[model samples]
Target: MLDGILAARPRGFSLAARYVAFALLASTLNLLVQMAVMGLYHGPWALLLAMAAGTAAGLAPKFLLDKYWIFYDRAPGRLRGLRQFILYGLLSVVTTLLFWAFEITFHWLGDGGPLRYVGAALGLGLGYWAKYHLDRHMVFGRA
Candidate 1:
C-alpha cells in the first residue's frame, strides 16, 4: 500500500497531472450543476437536492475519463464495462463520504457563499488522491 502510493514511475507524474486536470473538470461540472439546481429550486431540501444533482452530473464524465485516460483501460465488452463502473462506484462511496463531510462541515461554519465549495474541492482533491492508488491497485489490476 505504501509503495503503491509512493512509487515513482516514469508515467506516474504524467498520469497524475492528467488525473488532476480531469478531476478539476469533473468538480467544476459538479459544482455547476449544484449551482444551477440551487438557482431554480428553493425548498427545505434544496441543498440536498442540489448536491445529488451535482453528483449525478459529474459521475459519468469522471468515470469515462478515469477509465480511459487515467487508467488506460480500453477493454471491449459491455459486461466488463458495467463491472468496472460498479467497482468504481463501490470505491467512490467512501470518497464521496469524505467529500460530503467536508462540504457539510464548511456549510455549517460558513456564511453560505462558496465556503462549502471550497470544502468540496479540498475534500474531492484528497479523495481523488486516495482513489488513484486504489484504482491503480484494484480496478485496473495493476498489482
Candidate 2:
C-alpha cells in the first residue's frame, strides 16, 4: 500500500505539496506556541514576544523544506546559507506586518474570531506567494 501510494504520487505535485504542507504545519505549531506564550504573559509585549518566537521556530523548517524539497538547490556553504536565511528573516518580518495589518483591519471592519482567521489566511497566502517566487528565482537560481 505504501509503495502504491508513493508510486501514484506525482513528482512535482508531491514536492510542491509537501513543502507547502510542512510550512503550514510548522507555522501552526509555531503559532500555537506563541499563543500559549501570549496567554501566559497577558500584555502588549506578549504579542511581540510571541511573534519573535514564532518567527524563529517557523524559519528553520521553512528553510530546510524549501532547500531540499521545493527548490532542490545544491548545498551552498554556511555563509551562503546564512545569507539566504537572513533574506528569509526579512521576508518573515514583512509577512508578520502584513498579518497584523490584515488582522487589525478585519477587526475594525467588524470581524470576529473566524473572520480574523480569514484575514490571516489571505495575508499568509500573499506572503507565501511572494516567498515562493523569491526562493525559486533568487535564492535557488532561476526556476
| TM-score winner | 1
Total clashing pairs in model 1: 0
Q: Which candidate number would show the highest lDDT if scored against the true structure?
A: 1
Q: What C-alpha lDDT do the candidate models reach, one value each?
A: 0.80, 0.67
Model 2 has an lDDT value of 0.67
- Residue-wise lDDT of candidate 1 within 1-143, one digit each (tens)? 63343232335468768888988998899889999998999989888888888887888788877777777676789999898888888888888888888888898789766898998888888888887888777777762
Q: What's the TM-score of every candidate structure?
A: 0.85, 0.74
Which stretches in model 1 have alpha-carbon errors above 4 Å? 1-13
C-alpha RMSD in Å of predicted model 1 compared with the true structure: 7.0
Error of 1 at 77 (Å): 1.7
